[model samples]
Target chain A: MYGPSIDRLITALRVMPGIGAKSAQRIALQLLERNRDGAAELAASLIDAVDKVGNCSSCRTLCEGERCTICSDSRRSAQQLCIVETPADLFAIEQAGGYSGHYFVLMGHLSPIDGIGPEEIGLPILEAKLASGEVDELILATNLTVEGETTAHYISSRARAAGVAVSRIAHGVPLGGELEYIDSNTLSLAMQSRKVI
Target chain B: MYGPSIDRLITALRVMPGIGAKSAQRIALQLLERNRDGAAELAASLIDAVDKVGNCSSCRTLCEGERCTICSDSRRSAQQLCIVETPADLFAIEQAGGYSGHYFVLMGHLSPIDGIGPEEIGLPILEAKLASGEVDELILATNLTVEGETTAHYISSRARAAGVAVSRIAHGVPLGGELEYIDSNTLSLAMQSRKVI
Candidate 1:
C-alpha cells in the first residue's frame, strides 16, 4: 500500500512466464531486502548481459566478442554442423558435450500462424552457410514438434538441392522411459525408429 | 554464453524459488533479448526493492518505511489488533476488503523441529505490545494449518490471561468449493457454522 515503485517491480516481474501476482510480490520483497551492493550487482548484471550480447556474425549464436567460441574455434570441424531453432538449444547441446562440430543457430523455428517466416527467423542465413560448401552434414536439432518436422523437411530439401546431406535429430522415447509414461509423439517416433530385436 | 558473466547471472537467478537450470538459462537469454533500457529498469527495480524493505518498528510487518501503513493509519482501529503469520496473509485480507483494524505480523508460524522459538521471532515484543493495554481485542487470523493453530492457541491463552479479549477468524467451507472436493475439517467447520438450511 505504500510504495508505488513496488507495483512497477511487480508488474515487470509478472510479464515473465509463470510468475503471478504472489510470486511477483515475493520476488520484489526479496529484491528490496538485499543490501545496495547486492542489488547493484543484480542491476549491473542485467545491464551487462543486455548491452554485451550480440549476434555472432559467422554463426547465429549470441556473442559478446566478434564471433562465438564454437564458430571461431579452429579445432571444431566445419564439415559437421548442428542447426538448432534457438541459441538456447545450441547451448543445451554444447553442455551435453562430445560434439566438436560447428553450429548454425536458426534462432527460431517455423511458425506460420505466428507470422514468423523463414527469413524473419534466420533460415536463409543457414541456407547460405550450407551453400558455402564448408559443411558436409547438416544436423537438424530443432524440436520434435510438427512445426519442427516441417521446417526440417524444408531445410533438407533445400540443402540437398545444394548438394549437402541433412539429418534430423532423433526425438524418440527418452532413455530409461517407461512405455506407460511415453507421449503419443514420442511413442510414434520410437515405433518409427524401431530396429529388429 | 560468450562470457562467464552470463553463467553467473543464471546461477544467481536460480537461487529464487521454482527456477530450474533450464528455466534460468531461458530467463537469462530472455533478458539478453530485451532492450538494454528495459533490462536496466527491471534490474533497477530488483535492486531498489531489496534496498528498501525493512521490518516495521511497531507491528513488525515488512515495509519500506519505519512503520507499516496499518500501524501508522489514524482511521484504522489500533485498539482491535489482528495478528497473522505472514505479511502475505495480511495483504490478502486487505485485498479482500474484510478488515479495518491494525495488524501484528509474526513472520512465520511456530515450528519446534525447525528450531524456531517464540522469543526468536519477536513474541516478547508482541507480549509487551499486548500488555501495554492499547489493544482491546486481539484477532488471531493465523492459517488453519497445524503450526498456525498451535501458535494462535498459544498467543490466545496469553492474551486471555492479560484480560484482553481474543477471537479467531471463523473457518468454514470456502465459497465456490465443491462438497465432493471439500475435506473433513472444512465440512465440520461448515456444519458448526451452519445457519438457515
Candidate 2:
C-alpha cells in the first residue's frame, strides 16, 4: 500500500481503457519517482483538454471548436458523409488516407439492450443534416460488428427516405491478408461480393 | 487527425510507463468519449500527488509526511534495515508480508553509464543510518540485475565497515519453477545455494 494521494492516483489511472491495477501502480510509481514534471504536464494537459474539448457541432467528433478540422475544411466533399461509431474510427479512416469525405461520429452505436437509442447517438441531428439535402451520398463506415451493421441498416433506411443514396464499406479479406488465415464469414462475404474482373 | 487539445492529451498520456502512441490515443479518446469525470479526477489526483508527495526524510521513499508508514511505525523492528532499489520493490516486499523491518529506498541502482552513483541513490543517508547503530542487520533486496548487484555489493561494504551484519536475498529457482524450464544462470545459482535438508 502507498500513501493516500499515490493510492488515489493509481485508482484514477485505472479509468483509462485497458489499464488494470498493477499497471496503474507501475505508472503511478514511475511518475512519482522518475518523471514528476511529466506527471504535472500530463495533469495540466488532461485538465486543459477536459475543460476545452467538446463535440464538433457538425460531425459530433471531439474537438475544441464548433467544427472539427475535417468538417470545417471546405476542400473535403459535402456531397458524401461517412458515418462512424466513434471518433477513433473516423481517425482510422483518416489514417488510411483513402477517404476525402466528411464524417459523422455516432460516438456509439444503437444498443437497444443497453437503452442506447437514436437520440443517445445524435441520430436526430444526422437526420436533420440529411434533410437539408447537402449530403448526396451516405457512406456507412461503422465497425463490422453486429451493432455496427444494425446501426448502418437503420441509417441507410433514413438516408433512403431522405432521397440520399447510401453505401456500406465492404468487409472481406484485408489487403495482403492470406485467404487461408481469413475467417469463413469474411471468405463467404468475399465470395458473394465478387465483382467482374 | 484529432483537434489540438485532443492531440495534446494523447501526447501527454504517452508520458506514463509502457504507454505507447496508439495506447495513448486510445486512452485519451476513451476518456473524452466515456469518462470525462474520471479523466478530471485523474488530472486532479495527479496534481494533488505531485504537489503534496515528497520523499520520506528517513527512508527516502515517496510519502506525504516527514517519514514513510514503515519508517514511522513504532512496532516494526529498528534492528533490521532492508535496502531496496525503488519504492516499487519496497512495496513488493511489503505485499509479500514477510519482512517487518524498516526500509531505505535507493530509488535506483548504481547506473554508472547514466552517471548515477552513490549520492544519486542516497547511499550517504543509508551510510548515516548504518552509522547510527540502530540497525543490527542489513538486508539487500535490490533487483537481481547487474546494476542492482553492483549497488548491493557497494552498500554491503559500507555496512560491513559500519559493523552491521549483512545478507542478500536468495537468487535461485522460484518456488514453483521447474528445473527443466528454468534458465541456466538461475539453475546454477540454485545448485550453488542449495541448503542441507
Candidate 1, CAPRI quality class derived from DockQ: acceptable
> What tens digits encode model 2's per-residue C-alpha lDDT throughout A70-180?
988989998899999998888888988978988899999999999999999999999999999999999998888899899999999999999999999888789999999
| Cα displacement (Å) at residue A82, model 1 | 1.2
Model 1 alpha-carbon miss at residue B136, Å: 0.4
lDDT of 2 at B38: 99
Which residue pairs does candidate 2 place in steric collision? none
Error of 2 at B10 (Å): 1.1
Off by more than 4 A, model 2: none
- What DockQ, on C-alphas, does every prediction get? 0.41, 0.90
The true-versus-predicted C-alpha distance at residue B62 of model 2, in Å, is: 1.0
For model 1 chain A, the run of ten residues with the poorest summed lDDT = A30-39
Which lDDT tens digits does candidate 1 get at residues B23-92? 7778777667544555677787776666676789998877878987778889888898899887777888
How do the predictions measure up, each by TM-score?
Answer: 0.85, 0.97
